[model samples]
Target: MYYINKITFSMFITITLLWSITLTRIYAESRECDHTKCVKTLADTTIDMLIATRSVVAKNQDLINVDPVSGNYYFKGFVPAMVGSEVANDFSLMTGHKLKQTSLKLRNPNNAPDEWEEKVLRSFEASGYPKGAGFGEALVTGDNKIYRYMKPIYVEKACLECHSTKKNLRPEIRKFLEERYPYDHAFGYKEGDVRGGISITLPFGN
Candidate 1:
């Protein structure tokens, strides 16, 4: 009778510990998913708007015009790169997570790729821009505390204003880009070429 009671007590303790551990993990995952869902929504919406703007501009060149003298122009109060940089900065400021566009051939020095970003871009290229594959995800810092999302950006005719080769670029546009981004490597891309991507980082559980 004494031996049976001792065995029963041991089994009860073991089950309690297991249940506690499982609950902890479940809570952690729930927190992480909440963070990921928020970031994913923002990132996806921003990319969709950016792509839609590109399409609109491609269909109508006069939608946006360059102002070499003032070095600023607006179409509905948002320029392409301006919109990207603004959204990234604002989101990072508000949420404490980072979001921005990055590429192997980066035009803006600020948009330079991080380690994981470079790897993802290489994967896309090596895969020959496989159909229906436009995003990548991974954990950062060897921990599940943070997650990354990347969405591809493709070149459209509107992009050629600043992204075309020397011959294709307008003189004024080329001059503006050269003065602004002297180290720009984000040119020479044709329609349908994968230009780069919008990357978003989110912090999971505290």
Candidate 2:
């Protein structure tokens, strides 16, 4: 009788552990779905607004910056402010976390050559939208609560003047960047590469 009881207890413990794991997975999946859907919706809405307004106004043109080193078009200083105040404000109200946009340049002048560029490229290829395709979304954290949606902006021939390595970068711009960001790691990118990401982060609770 004692042996039988011990076996029964072991079986019950095993079953309970399995059941807990299954429940945890299910909950995680559900949370992921919710986060993904929220990010997608936000990206779609922001892109639509960008497309509609690109022709008429240039209020947000600062969001897109050109790097002279690699002829890459990327996001510059004021872009983050614009995103936080204008873009992220709305997203936060809708979702939970305050949204922010960031651009990681293909190469960094300061940091050691980590695989940062490669990782971004891989992520972009696997997850980013096609060239000029504009509009792809991804969940940053595995839980999917924090999400990023980005649009690809290809550098044009005209943009080469400011974005190419051959050209001289304006001193003012360089100074501005240095002062604002002591450890800026975004620079030296080529045309048609992933410049930056428009990210919306949902709060932990929500």
Candidate 3:
């Protein structure tokens, strides 16, 4: 009877242990999905705000003077590409998340993609989703922290002045681009083309 009681007690303890582990794993997975959803929402909001701001700026272009050299409207000194970089930097400082507008044909070298980013970019191209319909994936960084979110950026009519081909560019605009980015491949894009993307890396703790 004593041996039987001991075996029963051992079995009960083992069952409890198994139950605890299962519950912990379920909780962990739920938490991971929650974090990813939150990050995706934040990333989408950021991109929307950016697009609205750019649209406003683009609409106001007619009010500004043309660049004496470029012979095109100066956009009140707001270049969308330059503005995006600065905004991304400022937004990162405010949110503690890494944000960037990256591309294959990069105007700013800083926008070059890492391994995971390259894969996501290719996936976006292949997915056939409209530019506004962004997609995201959850990934574990080297430190085992969860990172998420990516949004595609489309070229607009306003974007063509700087991003279109040399044949389409004003003499001053081409010269300015040459001086700023000699290897600039970001040009030749048309309105409605998927120019690049915005990626947001959420904080590690979240």
- Using lDDT as the measure, which candidate wins? 3
Point out the worst 10-residue segment of candidate 1 by lDDT: 1-10
lDDT of 2 by residue, 26-46 (tens): 334434545555546545455
| 1-206 per-residue lDDT for model 3 (tens digits) | 01223333453355345434533443344335456566566557656666655555455444433554555554233456665576667666654567787887888787898877777777777756665777776766676565666777778888787788888876757777788787778988988887877787764344
Q: What is the number of residue pairs that collide in model 1?
A: 0
Q: Model 3: which ten-residue window has the lowest total lDDT?
A: 1-10
Better of 1 and 3 by lDDT: 3
What does the lDDT come to for candidate 3? 0.64
> How does model 2 fare in lDDT?
0.42
- lDDT accuracy of residue 63 in candidate 3: 40
How many steric overlaps are in each model, in order?
0, 4, 1
- Stretches off by above 4 angstroms in model 1 are 1-46, 53-61, 66-79, 138-144
lDDT of 3 at 51: 62
Positional deviation of residue 61's Cα in model 1 after best superposition, in angstroms: 5.5
TM-scores of the candidates are: 0.67, 0.42, 0.71
Superposed Cα RMSD, model 1: 20.2
lDDT of each: 0.61, 0.42, 0.64
